[model samples]
Target: MNIGILSDIHIDREHPEPNRVIEGLVNVIEQRGVAIMIIAGDIANDYERTLHTLHLIEELTEIRCLFVPGNHDIWNEKHPDKTSWEIYEALKAFSGNLVNGPVALPNGWTVIGDIGWYDYSFGSSQYPIEQFDQMEIDDRVWQDKIKTDWGKSTIEMHRYFFGKLETQLSAHRSRKIILVTHVLPLSDFTVQRPNRMWRYLNAFLGSKQYGELALKYSVAYSISGHVHDRLQQQCQKTVFICNCLNYASQWIENDDPVSEIARAFKTIEI
Candidate 1:
C-alpha cells in the first residue's frame, strides 16, 4: 500500500483562494498514486475551513483519509461559545474518517491518533516551571492557551491521549501500527540551536514520552506535525516523520502551492 503523508497545510494562509490550494493538493495526491492519506495536522485554523478542506478531498479524490487535529485546528477564538473539546467533537463529526481512536484499515494496518497536546517536557530542564509559566508575558506564549479549553494542563492532556494510544497499541499488537499526531513526538525533531524565544516556545512542540511509547510498543511508523521543519529519524524499530507545508511567508524560492504541497507530502510503501 502507498500512503501519503502531509501536515500544516494551513489553507487559510494560502493566498488568493483556498479552493485553488485544495485543487492543487488533490492533483498532487492523484499524481502520487496515494491510496491512503495521513494528514498529520494544522489543516486550517478554524472549524469551517478544516471541514471544507476535508470535504473537498473526500469529494474529489474519494481516497481514505485519516487525520488528527492540530492545535490551530481547535482554536476557539473564532467560536467563543464552544470549548476546544467540543470543537474537536465537531471536527470528528465533520470528517467521518477522523482517527481519535484506533481504526483497522483494509490494507491490514491499524491507525490510531489524536491531537496529542504537549507537556513541556520537550523544553530544557534548566528552565523551571516559573520560566515556562512566565512565557505568557513574552512573545513565546502560544495562542493555544487562550484559544482552546482542554480543561486540564497540557501535561494532563498529553498523558490522557498517550493512554488512549497505549490501549490501541496493546489491542492491535499483531498488526502494523501507524500512529499519527499533530505535534512532534521526539525532542530530536525540534529546531536545532533555537534562539531564546524559540527555545522557550519549544515546550509546546510535544512530549518525549510519546517517542518512548512508540518505541515501547514497537510501532512501525509515527507521523506528526507542529514543528514546521521537516524531519525523518529512526528510533529502534519505529520511524518518525514530520512533513509540514508551513505558512506561505516561510516558503522560499520556487515554492508554488502545488509544489509546496507535493514537496511536503511523502509517499511510503508498506
Candidate 2:
C-alpha cells in the first residue's frame, strides 16, 4: 500500500476557504495513487473545521484519511466554548482517528497516533524550565498559551501522552509500528536557524522522551510535524519524517496549492 503523509496545512491561515486547500490535497493524493492518507496534524485551527476537512478529504479522494490532531487543530480559536481537552476527545472519536486504538495492516504493521504534547526537554540549556513555563518572551506569546489550554502543564500533558503511547507501542512490540505525532519527537528535527528566541520556543516543539520511546519500542517509522519545515532523518532503526505545507505567507517560491502540496507530500510503501 502507498500511504501519503504530510502535516501543518493550517487551512485557515493558508487560504481564506477550504475549497482551494481541499482541491490541492486531492490532486496530489490522486496523482500519486495513494491508497490512504496520513495527516499528522494542523489541518486547521478549529476542531470542527479540522474534523470537517478530514472528512472532506476522504469524501473527495475515496480513501481512508487517518490523522493525529495538530496543536493548531485543537485550538479553541473558533470553538472557544470548547476546552482543548474537549476538542481532543472529539478528534479521538472521529472514525479515522488513530488515537482510539491501533490500526492494523495485513503485513504485520500497525499505525498508532496521538496529538502528542511537548516537554521542555528540547529547550536550550541556557533557559530553565521556569522560563519555558512562561510560554512567552520578548512580548511575543506562544499561541497555544492563548488558543489552547490543556488544563494541565505542558510536561504533565507530555508525560500523559507518553504513557498512552508507550502502552500502545508495548502491545505492538512484534509489529512494524508507524508512529504518528503532530508534534515532533526528536530535537534533530528542530529548525536549524540561529534565532535566539528559538532557544526558548524550541521547548514547545516536542519531547526527547518520545525519541526514547521510539528507540525503546523499536519503531520502524516516526512521522511528525508542527515545525513547519521539511526534514527526514534516520536515527538508529527509526526513520523520522516532517513535511509541512505551512501558511501561504511562507510559500516563498510559488503559492499554487497543487504545486505546494506536491512539494510537501510524501509517499511510502507499507
Candidate 3:
C-alpha cells in the first residue's frame, strides 16, 4: 500500500494556519492512492499549534495517521516537563493513534517508532562529551536520583526513553517492521549542519542505540525528521530519510524553488 511519510513540519510558528500543512499533506495522500500517513514528529511545538493540528485531524476521520513524538513536540524551550505521553494525550483528543512502540497496522505492516535521542560518537576527535566519560558521571547521578526520582536519574531517563525502543523492537519480532524516529542513528545525515545545533539535535533526536536496535530487528525502513535539510542516505542496509516540510529553505537555496522542491507531501509505496 502507498503511505505518505511526512516529518519536520515545525508548525509552532504557523499559528492559525498550522492546519494548512496537514491539509496539504492530506490532499496529496488523497490524490496519490495513499491509504495512510505517518508523521515522524515535530508536527507542532506548542499547545496552540497542537490544537490547530488537532482540529484538522478531527475533520479527517477516514485516513489512518500514525505518529511518534519528536523532541520539539514534547520539549523545545519553555516546556521541560512535557513528555511523549502529553503529546499522545493531545493527539488522542482528536482520535489519532499515537503509537509509542511497535504497533501492527490493519494492513499487517508492523511499525516500531519513537522520538529517539541523537547518537553521538564517544571516541570522535570532535566530540567533547564522550559517552564513556558521561557514562561514569551518568551512573553516579542515576544512583542518587533513584533515591528521590530527581531529573539527574540516568537509569530512569534511559528507561523512560531509550528502554521503550528495546521493548518495542522485542514486541515486534520477526515482523516486517517500518521503524520511525526523529533521530538519525548514524551521523551521515547530520554532517551538513552547524556543529552546536548538530550536537544538540543529536543528543535529543539521534541515537546509536536506536540504530543498533533497528539493525538487530526486522526493520524495513527508518523515517525521521529534526534536521531541517532533507536528504536520503543509508546506514548499512537500512535507508534513512530526512524529510523537510518547510518551503522556506527550498526558496533560499534556489531561484526556481517552487519547481524544484514543490513544497508538497510525498507518497512512498512499500
TM-score of each: 0.95, 0.97, 0.73
lDDT per prediction?
A: 0.82, 0.87, 0.58
lDDT score, residue 190, model 2? 80
Per-residue alpha-carbon lDDT of candidate 3 for residues 25-81, written as tens digits (9 for 90 to 100)? 556666677777777777665644654664565357366677776655655234445
Please list the Cα RMSD from the true structure of every candidate, rounded to 1 decimal place.
1.6, 1.2, 6.3
Say what the RMSD of model 3 is. Answer: 6.3
Looking at model 2, the pairs that clash are none
By summed lDDT, the worst window of 10 consecutive residues in model 1 runs over: 132-141
| Rank by TM-score (best first) | 2, 1, 3
Q: Determine the C-alpha RMSD for candidate 2 after optimal superposition of all C-alphas.
A: 1.2
Candidate with best lDDT: 2
Candidate of highest TM-score:
2
